[model samples]
Target: MSEPETRVASPPPAASVKVLSGVWRGLGPIVYALVAGGVLLLLMGRDPIGFYATTIESGLLSQTGLEQSIIRMAPLLLMSAGLIVAFQAGLWNIGGDGQFLIAAAVVAGLGAPLVGVLPYSLALALLCVIGFVAGAAWTIVPSVLKAWYGVNEIITTLMVGFIGIRLANLLIKGPFLSDRSLVPQTDVIPFKYLLPYLPGTRIHLGIVVALAVLAAVHYMQTRTSYGLSLRMLGASPKAAAHAGLDVKRDIVTAFGLSGGLIGLAAAVEVLGVWGYVRADWNPAFGLTLFALVFLARLNVKLVIPLVGFFAVLSIGGHEAARRAGLPNDFLLLLIGLILFFMVFTEWARTKGWTAGMRLRAAGRTSQREAALDE
Candidate 1:
């Protein structure tokens, strides 16, 4: 009798293709967000149509919603992408809220002076670099403490979140205060300073910058030695150390990079939307943005659409809430559901793969046993 040929089951080509589709990965979260909508409609005792109409009119139907989406996208994408860099290196940067507040203040002040003094393109580039530097500097303190002192990074970094918020208020109310003493924010930036918007939509050049950054980060993660080291450490810190990786430098750098991008997030908002640094400009945006980072399963590339999805949810959810007579709590319920999915997806990513392989092996073993029995 011939020895049976050994075979190994592989992931289907379709699985890879499906995963490559942006909509496919996001579809699950979208469905959950929708389901939350249904719950709100039920509770509110109102028609979902009226709610959607109002929301659409507010967020998408008019120029205003579109602009708001762009504004929201700016911060969400930056926060998520920055966090992506940190998370990839097995470092948790919960301080994005802090970093963004500080960077935003600096960028708002810097953006004003740079307007038209340099060519538009050049000024934009400068803004990006400035935002990156400010954000990175914002995070350095916590990074140093965590790296050198063996402090619990999550708590130390999160505590710093308050400082950033306080500083923003100080600038708006005190230092960066609008000269005329009109609004609680700073002066409106000249239209020339604003990043050009898409012809038909409120989306702007920041999206382009974000896309470029996302591509660069993705390539670095998949191709570079540093990226490989980060991945290895993510898998096992001890193994990374044994393999001679510089864990300390990587950790600090990761936080800095993460913080820098987050800083840029604030810059985009100030330049594009508020045009001036208002202490109240972001209003808890960092909190939900951190949520979006998690919703993206810590994948940098995935952050882009996940950010959009959340924007849509906020718009749609608010609409859904009013029509359904549901309260703001309904929105929270939806957010929690989306987060739960984010977590489950992570678990599924790991366990799903493991479970699948195990099943495949079991099936192969059973087939061999049947042949022997026969």
Candidate 2:
């Protein structure tokens, strides 16, 4: 009787398996890209290990280096967050640099006069709102063309960005030029308006705001019906329309929201770091941000880490080139290699090569188990 006691078997841990599967899927492509980059460096007669070591030491090992890297990531994070929205809606908003400049110019032109007239908090709030609105306004024409007339948003947005840069130059060199300095920059906002930095570091409130935006966007994309509609539209406009979604409205809304975030980023850059806008001093971060969005597969959760990774590379690349006599363009080569590998991996997955292999293996295992049973 004691030997006949029965015990319940626990079910297989499907949830843990699923979690591991997700982690592997997310990281596998990145690992492949790194290996490809290393091979490229070897082919070029460079020491890949030494390059990586220097990059790590210069970008992440030192406190000052880490602070600088995080500082550089602020604007990239903001632009990527905006890009995620537009890309998810199947829209290409390539004018983020222009939007960023226009927003900064607008805030600079407006904030100077309001600083002394309004309360500090009130003026800061107004400047932020105006920056956001100006950003959205800048994209209105492109969004309309895309939504109503089905124009190529890529071209329109890109052209509009050039116009924005010229306009910013006009504002800074003409109207907003500071009285004290001969430089082509606007008057600095009052010290009271400048955002305070984090204690013991050059990092400021903008980084915190960027993190908040990232979290909020992730929540919106994952938890809301609108996010589902945007994804549907991106996947297939005709199908989304068949589902009775307002495809046109969603397109415009997505572009506006994207531009708005870029504009807020501009405002934060000026208020938090520079406190003024300089003519022809654009970071030209649009292209870099665009690359990062794709590298992260348009996932907000992934954008944060990718942006930080890029910032480190950028800072370390410059340092390494200076100290080791390496070509600065080597960093660009690495980025291009990673992009190529990522694209290839995605193509393979789409063709079902990986899944087919897994299925075949499973079939072989099943057949062997049946033979043993027989």
Candidate 3:
């Protein structure tokens, strides 16, 4: 009789391995953050479980909290959409806070007056366009310098953001300051003219707009030749130039796209929720989301859940903090801890600790399966 044929097991598919790695990379920081946060709360003589339970009950379980969380996600989703594109192009548009504030100030300044002359819908559309243009315009110097002169975009973008923040304050204080009140804010758009809510819900249409932008960004990144070029540029600019890609144009385009989307986020906030811009009202979503984009691995789909989670923390954690006698800024501390662990994991990955362990585990599993078959 022929010798019995022995089956040899193969290692897990490379794609599956990658997916698992990505998932761990995404979730590991969250796990670490929770553990670290618990320790901090204990050290502070606080009840960690009680705090988390209250936060969950208030932010996610309660209907009002859920609605608020959804509403808060609107601007975050839009800003994250922009950051994805900028990050994909290997560019850092660190000035989103500035872009957001400036566009909002301009939109608030124009929205009320324009609604008086034209139809509200028409005015809303125009304001959105103006927001986009104002945001893109603010990035002109940085984009040009980065594209042509090879200047470090980090410094230029930051400096421009400072200038833009100051400019936004000036606009709210000077030109956009409302005559209706002494407060440093623009005239409010009439409630009737503001973006409408969904049927039987407090959620505004701004979330829909944010989702659409995110979908479009996903499509652009995955389905277009231009996206391939941008990916190549990010992977290695030298190789992209060797491949004859118009490197400068791509850089400028990435900046413009990122800025425009950030601007749209501001417009949506003004039109849908606030209906006016307040001086020194910078939410500074940029700093947190900057770390968050990296945490999401720059994946558009992944960003949705991450942003939702953050929104929930912001909405619910407030109530939890108040009840627990914790400072309101405690959430920021949690976020910073997540960022710290994320960087740690990244460093471990670079040192091959993570990858090596994963590979060895897979190898051993395959060997065990082969031995069983034999």
* 1-374: candidate 2 lDDT, tens digit per residue: 24322322432233444455455455566567667777877787777778777787898888878887887787778888888999998999999999999999989878888888998778887888888888888899899998899999999999999999999899888888888777788988877777668887878777988899889889888899998999898999999999999988999899999999899888888887778887898888788778778978899887888888888888887786666567777767666766776677668777867643454555555545544564
User: Which residue pairs in model 3 clash with each other?
Assistant: none
Clashing residue pairs in candidate 1 are 44-324, 44-325, 59-65
lDDT of 3: 0.88
- Please give the distance, in angstroms, between residue 31's alpha carbon in candidate 1 and its true position after superposition: 2.4
Better of 1 and 2 by lDDT: 2
Predicted candidate 3, C-alpha RMSD: 3.2
Task: Give Cα-based local distance difference scores for all models.
Answer: 0.71, 0.81, 0.88
TM-scores of the candidates in the order shown: 0.79, 0.84, 0.92
Off by over 4 Å in 3: 1-9, 13-21, 350-367
Q: Can you write out model 3's per-residue Cα lDDT over 242-342, one digit (the tens) per residue?
A: 99999999999889889889999999999999989889999999999987888898999999999998999889999999998988898888889999999
Stretches off by above 4 angstroms in model 1 are 1-26, 48-71, 116-119, 199-202, 316-330, 341-374
Residue range 336-359, candidate 1, lDDT tens digits: 777776566557757755333444
Q: Using lDDT, give the best candidate's number.
A: 3
Clashes of each: 3, 0, 0
